[model samples]
Target: MGTAPVAVPHLPVGSRLLVPVLAATGGSGRTTVAHLLARGLAAIADTVLLDLSPRLASSWPTHLAARRATGLAALPPDQPLTRTAVRAACAVEDTGPHILSDSRAWHAPPLLNLPELPAAWYQLASIGGWQAVVADTPHPLAHDLLTARHTGERALTRDWYELPYAIPVLCAPATADGVHALIRATKTLDAEALPLARTVVALTGTTDGRLPASLRTALAGATDRTAAVVHIPHDPRIRAQGQSTAHPRPRTRHASTRLTDAVLSAAHRMWGRPMPLAPQPAALP
Candidate 1:
């Protein structure tokens, strides 16, 4: 979070934004940040949480009690997804963001890959008129990107990082090892000439109190390369119970609000205009 008070930034009317929760390591609190961002953003935008994690690894379906929804698998392979189709494939709850993720059991085989590219998923969300899409990208994708860069074959990397009006929230645990991994990932993205300037660094607290001296010293070197560096406070419940749709503690929500604000600040910088407020709903007679 920045030194100033967090300002709420709504999406400009008829505009959409893709906010991908990206990370270089697992257990860096990627999905939890994505969920919190989605829930917080839902108050101002038509938000959808796209759980791009593997089927057996997905948490939203179970957390939301939407185990039977089939999620991504329910979409037809031969057709372009319509609003109705996307809605049907999602775990449409009465509140919070709609979830579109693979909810299959641990033993299931690989599924079909229509909307083949990473950008295609964002397009589907746009087609469905979602104002915001928070994609919980698979953990391995970052490692793959780094590998591709090193191997001199990065043809497949653009769609994930180069989408129009997309904001990348880079997450990592607030630890010496975790910060080192994050720095490496950032350098990779920078070398590839992706929009690293628009990125947000989220340091998920692995423990309480001041950051480890080593981690602080590491982050100090890379602070200038990002939009904002926000600390996601460690939540004991999340650490103990994992992610669920239930409300988080107040401080956790505060951190989430800061992250959302940073994202909106980055979006404002990208688009260069003041965002319009969401319209008020009509009251019942």
Candidate 2:
């Protein structure tokens, strides 16, 4: 008889890290950065990418609708929405060392009122060794403001101070025009949501070298809780591969190498230990 398959242990890492990546603007490469970060964190510990953009029409809506269709939606709306339901619907087979969950589908305006669901999902992910929860936040200031208000009113059964974990990583494109737009949007939101600033992640497109002074000032002016900037060069290689859901491609061998290095550096700054980088294949001709 063939030898029994080696039983691999579940939950590879000891501790979990939650990292939310949002954007100040819409096209600031939030999704790309979130994916990159998840891939990077996978090297050291288990990583999951939670896409929180409701507009993306991800699986969350379908799952929620299905639950309602099956008459399960009436089962105590106050109860936190569990991953059991979502996992079942999403058919998440690969709960391997790293799992990236796109949580954006549930961010719909209608779902925002369903506070228990998002909170419950987050809690479940935390318990499941989800080391990193990278979020691709929305663009408009209204989005953040509404989220904060709704989150407080609906999901603040726990200490209000701990809400930062649920906050997203805001991304702002690295163009003069984009940055200006983001500044206006963030400023308006900052008037009401103080924590909004902390979640901003500025995304600079391929540039010759260092960040520009104007963009730096614009980011500093924001009042969010934390800010991080990631620079993605304008590489035809990435676009040619069509990095979207319909044509998802693995990070290019060259990009993967640099991304791993950058992620390691960021991880050290954020989580103390630097993780091993993912292996890179030979560059394409």
- TM-score: which candidate is best? 1
Q: How many backbone clashes does candidate 2 have?
A: 21
Q: Per-residue lDDT of 1-285 in model 1, one digit per residue for the tens?
A: 769977655676677778888888887888989988887788778889987765566676567554467677777756656788888777755556888877666566877453446656766677677888898886554577777767876533456676667788888888877888888878777777877778988889977877767768778776668999999998898877767635667899999889988898898887776643322222212
Global lDDT for candidate 2?
Answer: 0.45
Model 1 regions more than 4 Å off: 1-9, 66-70, 93-95, 105-116, 139-142, 150-152, 155-157, 274-285
Expressed as tens digits, the lDDT of each residue in 37-92 for candidate 2 is 55555555555555454434443334334223222222234554444553332323
Backbone clash count for every predicted candidate, in the order shown: 1, 21
- The candidate 1 region of ten consecutive residues with least summed lDDT is 276-285
Error of 2 at 117 (Å): 5.2
Per-residue lDDT of 180 in model 1:
85
Top-scoring candidate (lDDT): 1
